[model samples]
Each structure stands twice: as structure tokens, then as C-alpha cells.
Target: MKVAVVKYNAGNIFSVVHALKRMGVEPLLTDSEVELRSADRVIFPGQGEASNAMNYLRERGLDRVIPSLTQPVLGICIGQQLMCRHSEEGDTDCLGIFDAEVKRFQPVKHEDKIPHMGWNSIQNCQIQNSKSSLFKGLDGEFVYFVHSFYVPVCKETAAVTNYIHPFSAAMQKDNFFATQFHPEKSGEVGQQILRNFLEL
Candidate 1:
């Protein structure tokens, strides 16, 4: 299967590439509308300011092209945030591929930090369809996460994790799948997740 990584001005691109490489899949990294639309599966991965990232996608017309992809699309970290309807980071609007919005974490009483970083375990993993191509053999697994904003627990949530509160660790909607955590950094559990996504 051909995997394509949407390229843009953002961080964490290579990390995703390296992770996929370990699976013996060399993905094409590009911003071209034609290239993206024709790929078997497309993965959008990013880590950076939402506004700038959106701006870059808009400049190349990928902002619209991405949401219309028929093939399964996966978003990681900032990519997941951008796939949502909007983000609080820059008061920015996003692809709206998923029926969700990204919001900043509420301040805590000297306990919770703004950017959540490190390995967190997921509980109450609601993988409604056991046959889901993603999460194939992985269940109740932990993944690495790093973010200041989050998508709340909802119907689309496939997995839930609690750091400050129960939040969406991973979500799936039709042909779109997203993970707030960085599976590439989560070791074995992560590899399983990526492999599952690939099989999708």
C-alpha cells in the first residue's frame, strides 16, 4: 500500500516518516493536491503553531483538498488538531473533517502543566467496532502525548486518557482517524497503533 505524508511547514514530519519506515513503508511527502488525492492512504502529521500551519496549507490549497480525501486519513498531534473544526491556540479555524474542536486546558492549582508531556495510559478505550482497521490488535494501551490543548471526550473518541481529566487520546470518524498522542514515540504500543492504521 502507498502511504503519503502531507508535507508543509511544520515540525514532527520526519518523526512520522521514520516511524513509518520502521514498518517497511516509505511514504511520499508532498503538498501537491494531485499527489495527495491519488495516494492509497494519507497521513497528515504536524507540530507547530496552528495559525502558521493552516496558513501554509491554505497557501497551497491543501486546506480544502485534505478534507475531501476519500482514502483513510490519519492526523497526529498538530495534524489532529488541524483536522478539527477549530483550535484555541491561535483562535484558528481548521479542516473540520472531524466533528470536534480543540480547546486549551484550564489552569490547575499548581499541579497541571500547560503542555502535557510524557507517557500516559489510556482507559475506557471505547473501540465500538472491534473490526476497526485501526486498533486491530491493540487494546487498552498507553501512548506518548505532548500538547497544551485537547479534544474532549465524545462519541468520536475511540480511546480515553486522563491526565487533568478524561480526554480523547484517539478518535475515529468515517474515513478519518486522529490521535492527540504521538504514537511514534510510544514504543511497542505505538508501533502496534501505527501498524493498525496502516492495515486500515
Candidate 2:
């Protein structure tokens, strides 16, 4: 199957590339509209500021091409945030695939961290649709996260994780699936989640 990893001016692309390679799939990393649209599956993963990433997507005209994809598309981290309606990170409007909003983490306590980095287990994970879940029936499984912003529990939310509070760990809307955590860096469970997405 042809899997295209949508390339943009964002970080953490290579890690996703390497992860797919380990699964025996050499993903096509490109910003080309033709390459992205024609692919069997697309993985839009990134790590960066929201506005900058959206601007880059806009400049390349991928901002529109992405939401139009018929095949299954997975968004990770900033990619997931960009799929939401809007983000507080840069006071930016996003792709609007999911009816969600990204908000910055506000620490209420001294121990509450801004970035909310490191491993955390996901809870309330269940099947949102007929497709296999991004959580892979691993509700209590820990995944790696590194972000200051999060999507609150909403209709599209498939899983929730508690850091400073409950937030979306995984979300699904039709063929569009997303994760706020870095599945590529989450070890065994993370790999299973990727496998689940590939299977879908």
C-alpha cells in the first residue's frame, strides 16, 4: 500500500519515517498535492508551533488538500492540533476536521507543568466507530506526550488522559484519526496503535 507522510516545515518527521520503516512500509514523505491525494493512506505528523505549521500548510496549498483526503489519515501531536477547529497556542484557526478546540495548559498547582511532557496512561478509551481504535483496547497503557496544549473531551474524543486534567488522548472523525501523544516514541503500545491505523 502507498502511504504518504505529508511533509511540512515541522519537526519529528524522521521518527515517524523510521517507525513506518520498522513496519516494512517506506512512507512517501512529500508536500506535493498529487503525491498526497493519490496515496492509499496519509500520515500527517509534526511537532511545532500551531500558526507556523498552519502557515506552511497554507503556503503549500496542503491546508485544503488534507481535509479532502478520502483515505484514512492520521495526525500526531501538532498534526492533531491542526486538525481541530482552532488552537490557543498561536490564536490560530485550524483545518476543522474535528469539532474541537486546542487550549493551552494552565497550571493550577506548583507541580502542574506547562509542557506536560513524559509518559502518561490513557483512560476512558473505547471504540468510537466501527474501525479499530487508536488506543487499541489498551486503555490503561502509557504513551509519550510532549505538549503545552490539549484538546478537551468532546464528541470526537475516543480516549482521555489525565495530566493537569482530563484531555483528549485520541480522537476520531470518520477516516480521520489523531493522537495528542507521540505514538512513535511510546514503545510497544505505540507501535500497536500505528499498526491499528495502518490496518484501518
Candidate 3:
């Protein structure tokens, strides 16, 4: 199976590639439209500012290619944020795969950090009387997260995690699946999630 990891200006692509390698899949890291479109599965993983990433995608014409993909596509961290309709990070418009908005986390208390980093457990939202395939065999599992902006719990939300408040830990809409956390850094559970995505 051909798995393609999208190459963009954002960081953390290498770690995602390493995770897939551990899963026994050598994925292609490419920005080429042909390579991305032909792949069995596409992984759009990134860590960076929203507007900057969007600019890169648009410049490379991936902004147009990504949403049209027929195969299963996974977006991680900032990649997930960019998949939403809009983001407050830079007052940016996004790909709109999931009809949701990304907003900056406002800390109500002193202990509540701006960037909700580190390990947090996600509760599967159980969409349509069943858990999402992304969370298959993994319920109430802790995943590594590092971000300040979050998509609020919405119709597309597949899992929820609370820090300052309840937010989308993971989301799914048709062939598109996304995670606000870093699955590559989430240990065994993360690997399982990647494996599930690959198998799908």
C-alpha cells in the first residue's frame, strides 16, 4: 500500500514518517500532486502557525488538491486546525473539510496554561452508535498534545478532551480524519491509531 506523508513548510513531518516506519510502512513524503493523489492513504501532519502553513499549501496548490482527495486522509495538530472552516490563530480561512472553527484557548485560571501541552486522555464521542475507526481498540487512551488553539466540540468531533474546557481531540468527516494531538508522540496508543488509519 502506498502511503504519502505530505511535505510542507510545517515541522514534525519527520517524526510522523518515523512512526509509519515503525509500523512497517515506508511512506513517501512528497508535495507532488500526482504522488499524493495516487497514494492509498495520505497523512497531512504538521506543526506550525496556521496562516503560514495555509500560505505554503496555497503556494504549492495543495490547498486545492487536498480537499478533493478520495482516499482516507489524516490531519494532525496544525494540519487538523487548517482542515476546519476558519481559525482564530491568524484570522485565517481554512480548507473547510470539517464545518468547524478553530479558536485560541483562553485560560480562565492561572494554572490553566496557554499551550495545553503533554499527555491527555481522549473520550471517544461514539458517532452513529459506534466509535470511530481512529479510536478502534483504544478507548480512554492518553495522547500527546501540544497546541493552544482548538476546535470546539462539534458535530464532526469524534473524541473530546478537556483542559481549559472540552474541545475536539479528534474529528472525522467522510474520508477525512484529524487529531489535534501528536499521535506520533503518543506512544503505543499512538502507534495503534496510525495502524488503524493505515488499515483503513
| Cα deviation of 159, candidate 3, in Å | 0.6
- Looking at model 2, report the run of 10 residues with the lowest lDDT sum: 127-136
Largest TM-score belongs to which candidate?
3
Instruction: Return the TM-score for each candidate structure.
Output: 0.95, 0.96, 0.98
Give candidate 1 misplaced runs (Cα > 4 Å).
Answer: 127-132
Off by over 4 Å in 2: 127-132
lDDT (Cα atoms) of all candidates against the true structure: 0.87, 0.91, 0.93
Model 1 TM = 0.95
Superior candidate under lDDT, 1 versus 2: 2
What TM-score number comes out for model 2?
0.96
What is candidate 2's CA lDDT for residue 78?
A: 96
Candidate 1, which ten residues in sequence have the lowest lDDT sum?
124-133
- Report the lDDT tens digits of candidate 2 across residue range 86-171: 99988999999999999999999999987999999988786454433666557788899999999999989888899888999988
Between 1 and 3, whose TM-score is larger? 3
